[model samples]
Target: MSTDAAELTARLIRCPSVTPEEGGALILLSDVLTAGGFECHRVDRNGVPNLFARWGAKGAARTFGFNGHTDVVPPGDLGSWTHPPFSGFVADGMIWGRGATDMKSGVAAFTAAVLDFVAATPPDGAIILTITGDEEGPGRDGTRAILDWMDQNGERMDVCIVGEPTNPEVFGEMIKIGRRGSMSLNFVAHGVQGHVAYPHRARNPLHALVRLLDQLTGAPLDQGSEHFDPSGLQITTIDCGNPASNVIPETARAVVNIRFNDLHSPDSLFHDIRAKADLVQAETGVSIEITSNISGESFLTAPGPFVDMVAEVVAEQTNRRPVLSTSGGTSDARFIKNHCPVVEFGLVGRFMHQVDERVPVEEIHALKRVYGGMLEKFFS
Candidate 1:
């Protein structure tokens, strides 16, 4: 008997696997997958749960991998939901729950498709599933940990599909060939504190901080790359905590987040910002300090055989030629890109991370068909 994707999605949603919490979701999935002939491993790291399942022998001539997250963001304000966020209610031809679209459904669809595919055809190559629990949180211990373990254990994949919700408005409209990199920088300007009335006695770090921000955001990062939009930098927060009306603060802090294209890297951008801060420091005596965290670097899997294969299956299943896009925020794809050619495809993302998140029952079945078709083609 084949597993129903909709029922599996409903079962997953009811687990309350929010962010870092396993909430029994992985255990449930491991049980189902183990019975389906997959070798399952509990790849837990730093209290974050992850499941890695594989079908077929390791180091086969070819390997196909799928990556997804079981965890969903918190459902905010219980009163704002029409149905309880974790109810997994099946009504109105849709599954109602927090992870319905942002992607318990994606996981279910792919899992079911793979199970049915192996049972029916048993592909020539390997099938690997790397599902993580901390994708919505810090992300340091989720997919990254699984990949690290794979490296140590001599596991490899030729190509991978990330089941991130990729379509914006409708299913089959988009497939992500790549993603822009993301990094955040915290800036602190330090100066001597003094009374406001004696303006000459103490330098106000706020003034230098403003100039530093202006310098960073004054120009565009790029004129858009071939496969990406222009890079963006936004000042997320600025703070000078002095509450007194007549005092000059010793430090002014600001945070800037940059979503960059292939043309720039975290190191390059850091140097660029440092150059601007250097000018501000040279002009004013206030010293500037910058600390940065780079989430992932931009990557692209050029349109080729693997990409063309997935796109053809999507078009055949949905009759819409999916656009190869690199427009969304980062995902586990960022980590997988280093190991293999990766693309992201799943349900429409219009409801992801929003209140009353849901996915139509029909779309779930359609996605399973698309994934199943891909499996047939890839193995054939």
Candidate 2:
């Protein structure tokens, strides 16, 4: 790995910025960006610190943005890690840490590559880097605030590349042109408490919830779109919350999530899914209530010249033809797509968000080269 990449990755890993907390991660990035001649903005929105940095001459109509987050999911059961989760240990030609590949590494790569690129030659066009700290949590802040700030600042981008780790098996093997929108729902069916055998005396919410699941998951949401696949709805959980063996619980609940393609909107999809639950209400005495835990709505960027430029530079640097795809979970890219055409391409993500997260040191250098080349080619 390049020393700059290794040093910066180690710095980020040491910050301990587990979702919603800065933990020094944002400071590390801000310092790097400031040194690179970019004007940096530190905005605290909804309690999360988001950074937006830009560098280039005025009137450069062509602006490129690199977006990603500094936060990572919690390192569950710390005992499961081979090395300390925040140690940033290096062995076997890889770096091991929480968010090492999921992707503090990608953040480091883009930042360092931009620093180097700008130092050698002042950017021919504007380059903006948007970093957020609310990706793995409630996500009520972060990117949404950054985009709003950009709009108020009169910043428009030609294209934005989100450095989420997109590769599965080989570096540069996949580029996510879009993401499946995700929505999570918790449904509760209310009924009267009763004996197991008393059917008419008390409504059985459990039965209503079970039948509702049947109708909801019975078929595919749609046949898939040109840049996306058929919408999908998966039941993540179900609970009667009844510990008693002989008594029918007064309430039953189920939590479900859907990764939808462009075929549906979160509002429409939620309305449709809720209608199925309401059908049970029409026939039964039970009451139904549904609530949402939103991740993001699905979004896509139609492949065009800017996307082509990223693909060509990636193949040229890594010699791996990137697969143009939108087949992944939701990301901050989902939010950025509304402002500009955004695509995601980065290091191999085999071990991201997993115990003992690690990235091959070789891949780090390759990603840096790819990012540097993309910046040079796009603005030249």
Candidate 3:
């Protein structure tokens, strides 16, 4: 049986499963895996589809899993691409589409590798795949849900490898080992409305809000951690409208997002921020309220046999030492981290979510070889 990597990636790219929509993308994969001597199961949760498949020894000792998502972020500014964003056209030796580099390509490469691995000899250990459709949007819809499902169904994994475009300068440059936590907060300061000319008659919320923001931004959340960098807090937005220069605004609002390391927790940051706001209010009459959105917590799996296996495979196949970096933003790996030791690596990511995003045909073939090597070594 032949495993055509390009054709599989093109089929997946054709479906514009942007965010919460599957666009029949998972079905395409289910068909392919089902025909490849693997048992496939589909679970639809909260209007999103998550697919799981397995092969080789039943109840094997080590259940190695390949985890990925089929969804793509919206192709921003549609007018910028050379071809339709969902067309998945092949031109200039690239399979052009939105999810080509961010993901999808990595999935196809590994699937092809698995097919090749099984053909040579039945998989040495149990191989499982968890493909979710809600990764690009509110993560609550996919990996998090599917992981719970896996646990309930008695599915366990010894190790998990996420295909999240870990390469930066070139293929095989980086393999992410951990990720920092992400949290967002919005605070609005309240004050009495009055004419600016009568300073004693009204409280200015802007004055207190500015002070609160100053305290939050003045210092680093922390010095660099042993294995991670210092935490960063950025003020994303601040709005205070007092259309009239002669009037004091009733409210002033600011939004801040913090990318924190293991040194800090959401609870600690919330208290620290509130303390700063309180101090500002003690000096000014403005009172404030805060709301938060938490995406994930920082997590790292100490370098061990599982991570070493992937690094060694890349070294042998690419003939270059791969850097195990925890550098980019977070991914579904955040959800997977709760259940199993997870890491991400894939194609060059210079084009993810960009107009005319694509991966070279040669690069696709090379990636397939690297994946094949990894699977072979893991099962050997």
Candidate 2 per-residue lDDT, tens place, 164-271, comes to: 999878887899988888888899999888888876787889888888888988888889988887877888888886779879889999998888887788888889
Top-lDDT candidate index = 1
Rank list by TM-score: 1, 3, 2
lDDT of 1 by residue, 1-380 (tens): 78799999999999999988998889999998999999999999999999999999999898889999999999999999989999999999999999999889999999999999899888898999999999999999999999999999988989999998999898899999999999999999998899999979999899999998988888999999899999999999999998998999999999999999999989999998899899999999999999999999999999999999999999999999999999979999999998999999999998888899989999999999998998888888
Extract clashing residue pairs from model 1.
none
| 10 residues in a row with least lDDT, candidate 2 | 1-10
Q: In model 3, which residue pairs have backbone atoms overlapping below 3 Å?
A: none
Candidate 3's TM-score:
0.96
Off by over 4 Å in 2: 1-3
- TM-scores for candidates 1 onward, in order: 0.98, 0.94, 0.96
lDDT per residue, candidate 3, 253-294, as tens digits?
989889888898889989888888788888897899998888
| Per-candidate clash tally | 0, 3, 0
Candidate 2 — what's its lDDT? 0.85
